[model samples]
Target: MRMSEKRAKMVMSQFKFLFFVLNTTGLYVSHESRDASLGFMVQRIRQMKFVGSVALLAFGHRLTASGFTTSPHLSPCSQIQRQFGHSITNPTRFEASVTQRSLSTKPLEFPENPSPFSTIKNGILTLHHRLRNEEVLQWRALAFSFFSSLFLFRHAIDVKLASLWTFLTTSSSLIPRIFRTDSYEWVLAVSAFFFYIHFFWYADVSVRKASEQGKVHPWRKYRLQDRFEADKHRRSVELKLRRNGEIPSQNELVKNYSEVTKQTGWNWKAWTCEVWVYVVPLLTWDILSPRRHRRLAAFGAPTTIQVLRDITCGLLLYDILFFTGHILMHKIPLIYRTIHAKHHQEPEVRAGDVVRLSMVEEVLEVGFSIIALNLLGAHPISRSIYNLIITFLLTELHCGFDFPWTPQNVVPFGLATGSRRHHFHHRNGKHYYQKFFFHVDRLFGFFQKDDGSLHGDSVKPNPHIPPAWQ
Candidate 1:
């Protein structure tokens, strides 16, 4: 039963006892059979309590209803029966006035009809009530961003903007001939990986240190802070072992040491591993790939309009193609062993894992993204620009921070798959294989969490499910 009903029953019992005392004192009943008479009166009150909604009136109570008056003796009062019933207020706080009329019975007296505050509040409430549709708000954000992008693109193309063009032209003259072609994009892509990953390493490690000292994060609410995830996991596991009084095996000790080594913002050994692994394949692709020849021949200084359009298309194409390749790499056991499994080596996807793929995997990513742009007849400058954008995206997707203003959160319609999703893939190795957009993941129903929640803009509440290493 509801709490209010329980409370009402308790109050009713008290009233029954009170009436029995009055009967014992010979105030309402004088006959020797007063107990029997009191029992019947109490039974009638209980019946009315459960069966109907009506005001309760007993001896000497002021009731203003028609054909009801105060009774002086124990008798069958016909007028005490129910007339047109009205709802009774539930007992709250055991207030004495609960069964009696309120002292304040006057209507609200106002001096004005269209009061300034009342008009303003009603107008605001009407708007809030009308805008309760989630789909409408999503569409509104998307529409506003689309029109704003179009205006900027058109303005950039129409205006020459000599200062910006001069700066670029002057810089190109100083650059080497190799970079004048498509090598600049390769350099740009690599540079973006380094800059972003390094920053996250600092942000994450600083926050962790602050927490150890029982200090508030200096500026945590402004920016996303998770960066050194491998170290974070190591610390968490080490803390559990000490707190639970467990003995550690030799293998567990070594694993914790390895995580400690990764705590550095800069790891020369791992950095060396990634660079050589990427460069060997990169040199081979540049020297021999058939697509490079085609890209060099069609290369030009693309207009601002063309560059922006290709960047947009490249992001979409990359998402779909990457989604397919990523899914296949996980589903096919042989492929996972030979290629993609290397990227999953870390307990958590962190700053360093941005380029942690094996040679073949790296080559495929560079190939699909650059070659796809070439197929669209994008100029080398446009391709170079797109490379820079996608590099930042790839780094941040696994950077392990889901800050509100990040590109993942900025995108409308729950599309971008931020660091949180990739973190989930590390834990389960079963779902959320896509990198950027939710389109492919949604179609396959792989967008749901392990517990089966659909993807949304919010971070999945528990990103750190137990690791396989544990």
Candidate 2:
């Protein structure tokens, strides 16, 4: 009797342990299956073609098995004795028919071989990746650098060095016959002649800035944030004034514009002014020089011819250098940030602000003009015409006006240029540096889109101000 009782107790303990194992295993397997099913649902939702869908389903099955095996409760043959000791079924076996069926079914369909057009798609993707690389832009930089340098070297004639000597030696025979005449045509002609020689350097700034950096310096961000805040405060103040029946006048408008224009100060003026200062003495020295006879004979002509020649030659030099510099300025950072940044202070530039630039900036501009003139040494006459065309273009750019100019109906083109482009540079000195042409900026993905509105949507045209005050 005692031995039988001990045997029964041991048997009972074994059964309890088996039951615990089975319950644990079942819970674990169920949890795992649920997790795997969630994963499969996610994969199906993505609908990643046929192959990807199949792969995801396979992954789900593997993960479910892993989760089941890792669980302590999901053991096989647990609690079998208690569950079926007295009443055993025909066969005690566990088979996952549902899981097998789901795994076997195809959720996505695809052709064994993709269509022939697939080859074209693959080729396009390959080309796109290749074109996106930085190496592709290197040639652009090199081309810009070469052209800008060429223009700068050609047109850098130091005319100011002899102006003073020419004046003091008015009594000298070296003075041209044109100087004695009070003719307006002759004066206009002379002004036109030397205009290129004198202003070629001025127009070269755009090129030099462009070649140095594809975009403006990053300091532009700070400036922009500041502008936004300042504008906000100004508007608030203006609103308060209007509430008090106060109206802002023309002086107030000018003051507001002045503040906006102060982004870059006239640092270029310092250098240009110095150039002129020393140029006067140099001109005087040249005039008094004993070699004045030969020098005048070589370079001196009617003031009109000289003006025309200068204008034409100056622009030829300017155009090549300007375009090249504009391209490179966006490419090279050090050049753009430090050297080209000074001009960005003026968010809204005016005509007068064009010449009032820093010397460093001016030199870069002038350098390109000189290089361009050298390359176009075909003839003074041809060079002058080219230079004048380019000069007008540059002046138009510098003037901060975007007058609506529609092209011929057949062409259906409009003038895409604007001071707003330059204004943005001044607003944020670092982001949109490329000017004259938006090619480099657009290419590098730095170009800012214009909304054809001032200060973007920030400031609105308030027609009520005048009426409110009255």
Query: Top TM-score: which candidate number?
Result: 1
What is candidate 2's CA lDDT for residue 316? Answer: 40
At residue 147, what lDDT does model 2 achieve? 50
Candidate 1 collision pairs: none
* TM-score for candidate 1, residues paired by index: 0.55
Off by over 4 Å in 2: 1-320, 323-338, 386-389, 404-418, 430-435, 450-470
Cα-based RMSD of the predictions, in order?
A: 16.4, 22.2
lDDT of each: 0.57, 0.42
How many residue pairs clash (N, CA or C atoms closer than 3 angstroms) in each of the candidate models, in the order given?
A: 0, 78
lDDT score for residue 20 of model 2: 46
Write the residue-wise lDDT of candidate 2 on 241-343 in tens digits: 7888999554443233112212233335533464464245435654565342443344432233344465555554454456566546656888767655555
Candidate 1 lDDT by residue in tens digits, 328-349: 9999999999998888876556
- Highest-lDDT candidate: 1
List the lowest-lDDT window of 10 residues for candidate 1.
Answer: 91-100
After superposition, the stretches of candidate 1 with alpha carbons farther than 4 Å from their true spots are 1-153, 156-158, 161-172, 175-182, 218-270, 280-301, 449-458, 461-470
